[model samples]
Target: MMNDVDPQILARYAPRPGRHALLPSLTPQQQVALLCRVLHREGYNDHIAGHITLRQEDGTYLANPWELTWAEVKGSDILRLDAQGKIIEGEWNITPAINLHIDVHSARHDVSVVIHNHSEWGSVWSAVGRVPPIYDQTSALVDTDPVCYDEYRGTVEDSELGRAAADALGEHKWALLANHGVLVVANGIRQAHLRAITLEWRCRMAWRVNLLGGGVPLPAAVAQATGQRTDASGFPFLWEAMARDEIRRDPSVLE
Candidate 1:
């Protein structure tokens, strides 16, 4: 991918230390709005059904309020909710699925962001509990073995069901909610949003491969090595590119 680029030019783009220190400086509202724009750009917007939650330093979280479409989301539209899912600050009520997000966040301290979306290809792939393989470098950004939550207890209105889903997710960064859609969790909103969009793209690729007679899986050793390398350093660049593009397309999201 870096073909023909000068070594000096490539060096300028290399990952630098202290790059992630800026993440914590972002307010919860800014993080939520930026992620919402990223998801919307990736076509993950299922009207107002999808939600992204960013953990706050004060043990609360910021999530998109109900009735606001992803494309319409701005920093002002984000709702601050306590750990119990009660809206502490916002004009609109929380989505019923807030319980699900709350459970996952409570269970996984390592997870600073949770993204749940009924995205098109993600939903189609989840119908059969299929987790996409490491088909390419981009696909390898996700876990080689993503979790598949085979039990769909209607809506995740009950906290118990939410915990069950979190149990199904275990320690994986990606989860295919069987008969529903996909959920991606990560240490930051950028990574979570990047993984969600990557999952959907991987599923689309896998579906096409199945139609044209199944293809051979990458060798286990190669898959594992590629996954490790990509997972370590690929996502930030992808996230930055997408975020910049989204901001250029619609600068109002930052407002």
Candidate 2:
């Protein structure tokens, strides 16, 4: 067995500078590619209306430039933005949803990754106002009633709107933007993407099950236990495995 090195030593080697990288360690390029694959696989390109973002090593954020579809999105399309939503790097127009991104990232330190998508299933479930509780082990991916509603009156143009939306999400991992779509967040890009995918899966299942004469949902205790054990490896290992494969197969994704 390896002798345990001082935990402090390991900590100091983290992504940020000598402070041991208080922030996550993803490069701008990696953040972009992961965003692309996340949207691509989830079919968020249908309207090309979704976006993903990750905090860079310097506490800045990497997000997709406006109008870039998930499939056509290259890593070069990723724009670096400062805390005030000003572009710090890259050559692309910023999207209006930048405020939503900035508000959430600034408000929640636990969230290093954020994905906003208007998918068929996620949107469909959100349209219903009330999101049903966990219906299965997979549904428990939400963990502690993850879904919230915004009652979307219009685009989130102000910090108040964004804050309200974020508030609806509370401390949960996911939320439903009423009349708009869904947002998923996590401490890492891969984990956020995984939560987004799983949230949609859970939504789809809820819809299907509801069709069969209103199927029974999982017990609360079961959901709690399932959610607790779901991340035994500390992250969505399976989703990260696939994400790593995606990057491996298409190195150009980082171009």
Candidate 3:
């Protein structure tokens, strides 16, 4: 007997592999660099004003250095750093402001990746110092309404500011750094990248709605259901496609 497949189950299942699919073989550096380039094309590049870090099993972090633009990140450019933010590998320096990533890692052991960037639309909402409404269904791909850290304390060069930002983020998957940018934390790189991209999308749409002066909220129950479905995504379909696209554009990114 053939039973109708539950759509929910499908959402939670892995997608069939494409011709170039090879998820598990990718290294931490390669993953982080790929994320940078993917987001870079999405307008997340603000000079060298962003950082993406992946946590290691023993609490060290793999991060992009202060020298390279996200658009030009290659796997070889990733630096390994100790818990105390000391460089353990690679020949480049980390920003003292990396305390933001370090503190978030310290506070959330479940988080595998932390991405912060002064992205275009996200910065527009950040300047407004409020959580933008979830106008598009795609925007709800992120966890609910992102909380706002409606305070700017310069560039987070010290642990104090970083810890404060992490505290503000609480358990939310992403937060808007008012007058600055966005911070996203996820259990894996794929979810983190998706959240970062969707955060920008939501901000962009919200701005359009604001400019036109008409915006309607999705019912709370409907919005919650959408978020649950989006969160249930199991495979790396979005990340895998974006990554492969970047690789096709610049093979050097893998080196």
Candidate 4:
């Protein structure tokens, strides 16, 4: 028998920060490597065109090396760069385009992790010069509709272009990189990883729906409520499950 529920009691059921207790017991380097392998499996691999960076306690950063594809990256291959962007560790080089991460980190103090990839489906949407309307419920996992950097000033090879893209991203956690790819930012590994995967899936589904003559999206109030439920903690349990697949596929990533 259903009865009137107490609002305070109902609030207790909502997602909380420490609710997902199954966190990966790995170092930051190992975590980054595992996420790269997982993202590669999830279609974020695009030769050597993608990058993931984690800002460190000393204000330096740890990023993937440039010579290898995201799939081939391991903990040992991760690089540490000084705040000046010079490689202070690792046997390989970090991409110059990492300036994009630098700029975003500067612009948004809340972001501790930044991921950029020229993924297949995401690239397709990037060419459209605008965000695809959210038609599916899962796409609502994002904080908001991504800001599109439509100026298309070529590759983000310099600080100026990086700043422009970051400016377009503004306060949003996601962005469509004009004629390029996608950018996802968050304060944790789980959030950033999940957002990247969700952003790509959102674009993939949106395009498919558009081809099918399109359908109506969830109402703003409903979608916003859904996002509130899903966005909290970025579904850490899902991250643990997906990360397990990567760990089982190659145990050496923990190196």
lDDT of 3 at 141: 73
TM-score of each: 0.86, 0.81, 0.90, 0.89
Residues 73-131 of candidate 4: C-alpha lDDT, one tens digit per residue? 88888999887678999899878898888898888889989998898788888988878
Q: What are the lDDT scores of the predictions, listed in order?
A: 0.76, 0.69, 0.82, 0.81
| Total backbone collisions, model 3 | 0
Over the full model, what C-alpha lDDT does candidate 3 score relative to the true structure?
Answer: 0.82
Per model, state how many residue pairs clash: 0, 1, 0, 0
Please say which candidate is ahead in TM-score: 2 or 3.
Answer: 3
> Which window of ten consecutive residues has the lowest lDDT sum in model 2?
1-10
- Ordered by lDDT, highest first, the candidates read 3, 4, 1, 2
Instruction: Report RMSD (Å) for each prediction in the order shown.
Output: 5.3, 6.7, 4.4, 5.8
- Candidate No. with top lDDT: 3
Report residue 101 deviation for candidate 1 (angstroms). 0.9
The candidate that wins on TM-score is: 3
Tell me the deviation in Å of residue 188 in model 3: 0.4
